[model samples]
Target: MKKREVLLLAFAEHPEQREKCWISLSECNFSCKGCAALSKKERSRLISSKDLAYLVFKSSRYFWGKIIKIAVITGDEITLNPESLLSLISNLKDYSVKYFELSTNSFMIDEDLLKELIKLKLPILVKMDLKAYDEKIYKEYSGKSEVRVDESLNLFEGIDRRAKLIIKNWKIRYLTINPILTSK
Candidate 1:
C-alpha cells in the first residue's frame, strides 16, 4: 500500500491554518525533550519548501491571512536543513508572505543564518526550545547539558536581530524550562 503521509499541528493557532498547509517534520535528527509531538501519536512527512508553498497557496482559504498573513511553524528543531529553511523563508518572503512564528530547538541554528533570515524583515518570530533553565536540568532533558542552556541563553542575549524583525527571542517562550516532561 502506497500510503500518503500528511501531518498537521493539531494544536495549531487557527482552525484555518491546519487546513491551509499540510506540514511535516524536517526528518530532524535532534533528540529533543521539549517536543510535545514526540510523546504524542501524530503523522508527518519530509516536504520541500516549494511543496509547502504550493500546499499553502492551494489552501489559501483556510490560511489566516487568506493568503495574505504569514504562516507559523512550531516544532522540535526546524533549523536542521538550513537550505530548506532558507528556501522556505525566501519563497514566503518573496511572495510577501509572513511566517510569524516558528518554535525550534536551537541545536543547529547558527548566527549567520539568523542574520540572513532577518533581512527579509518579514516579522519572523522564533521560539527556541531550551531543555531546561539550569544546566543540570537542561542536560537531563536535552541530553547535552554541558552547554545547551548556557549557549541558548547566550543566543537570546547576544543575537542582535531587530525588534520588528523579532517578536520574542527567548530560548523557550513559556515557563516550561525543561524540554520534555513524561507523565510516568
Candidate 2:
C-alpha cells in the first residue's frame, strides 16, 4: 500500500488543504471600506510577535520541505512588526526556501526597514497598495491624517535602487500607485 499511502500524503498536502499560517501583525482601530482582509464592521485580531513568529517558523518548515510557496499576507500593517518580521525573514533565508510572497497596504513600512530588506535580498515578492495620494484621502482610509506621501515616495525610491540587487532568482515587481476615484 505504499502507492496508496503516497497518494494520500499528496492529497493531504494540497494547497487548499495546507494550513493558511497567518500571523496577525497589527492592531488596527480603523476599518477601511475596500480592505478585503478586514471585517466589514469590526476589526480583526491583534496577534503577538512571538505567536506570529512561531506561525511563520512552522509555515517555513512545512512548506519548504514540500517545495510549496508561503504566501505571507498581513493582518493590518506589516511595518508594525518590523523586527519580528526581519527575524522571520532570517529564518526563511536559513531554510533556503527561496520563495516568499507579501501583500501590504504600505501604511507602516518605512525607509530604514526597506533598506534592511535590501540588505537581506531574499527571494521575496512584495505587493504594496497605496490608499490615495492626498493626505486627506489616506487619512480617511487609515485614520492617520499625517500620512506622509513623501515617505511612501521614498520607499518606492528605495525599491528602485535595490531592484537590481534583488535579481538573484527573485521575481521582483512593483505595483505602483494610489488613486481616489469618486464616481459621482
Candidate 3:
C-alpha cells in the first residue's frame, strides 16, 4: 500500500547495537522547541509500504545473514500514523528480524493501537521516553498540558491475553526519562 506520509529510509551501523534499518516518518504532533528532526533542513519523499518492506528485507540480506539486529520505526511520532506503521510491519512478516523497536513519545498510543500491535505477533521493543514525571516540566517541554505519561502506561497494561509474549517475557523496554530541554 502506498502511503503519502512516510518520508525517508536509511541504514546505520551501531557497534553496540549492530546493523539497523531506520525509517523516518514526517509530521510530528509535539511542538518541542529543540527537536533535532524538526530543526533539520531536509525533506523526504513519500513511499509505499511495500517498498519500505522490500528495503527492510533487502537490508537484512546485505548484512550476509548477520541479522538486522533492530528495525527501528521512528519519526516525530510514528503513532500519528498508526496505520502506516502497522502496514509496514505486517509486510515484514517474512523477514528474520530479531526485533522491531518502535521509538515513540508514548503520547499517542492507546488500547486499540496496542491491540493491533499485539496482532503482529513479532517481538517488539517499545523505546518510550517518559519526558517528565512532573506536570510543569512536561508542559514546558512538550508544549502540551495533557500530561499522559501515567495514562499511556496504563494503556500498555491494558493489552489483552494475546500480548502475553510482550509482558510476560519482558520484551517491552521503557527508555530513560529525558525531557526535551528548552530555554523557555
Best by lDDT: 3
Candidates ranked, most accurate by lDDT first = 3, 1, 2
Error of 3 at 178 (Å): 30
Ranking of predictions according to TM-score: 3, 1, 2
C-alpha TM-scores of all predictions: 0.64, 0.55, 0.73
Span of 10 residues, lowest total lDDT, candidate 3: 170-179
lDDT of 1 by residue, 1-184 (tens): 1112224532223333332232334334455565556324533554457765655554553434455365566554566666777777676565556555666777666676677677767767776665566877666666664374355446656655544343332221111112222222
**Model 1 ranges with Cα > 4 A deviation:** 1-6, 9-24, 32-35, 38-42, 62-65, 156-184
* Error in Å for residue 177 of model 2: 33
Say which prediction, candidate 1 or candidate 3, comes out ahead on TM-score.
Answer: 3
Q: Which should have the higher TM-score, number 1 or number 2?
A: 1
Please give the CA lDDT of all the candidate structures. 0.52, 0.47, 0.66
Across 1-184, the per-residue lDDT of candidate 3 in tens digits comes to: 3363444555665534466677766667788767887324335455667776776676556654554656788877888777888887777655666678887988888878888988888888787766677888888888875557567777776443232232222222112212232212
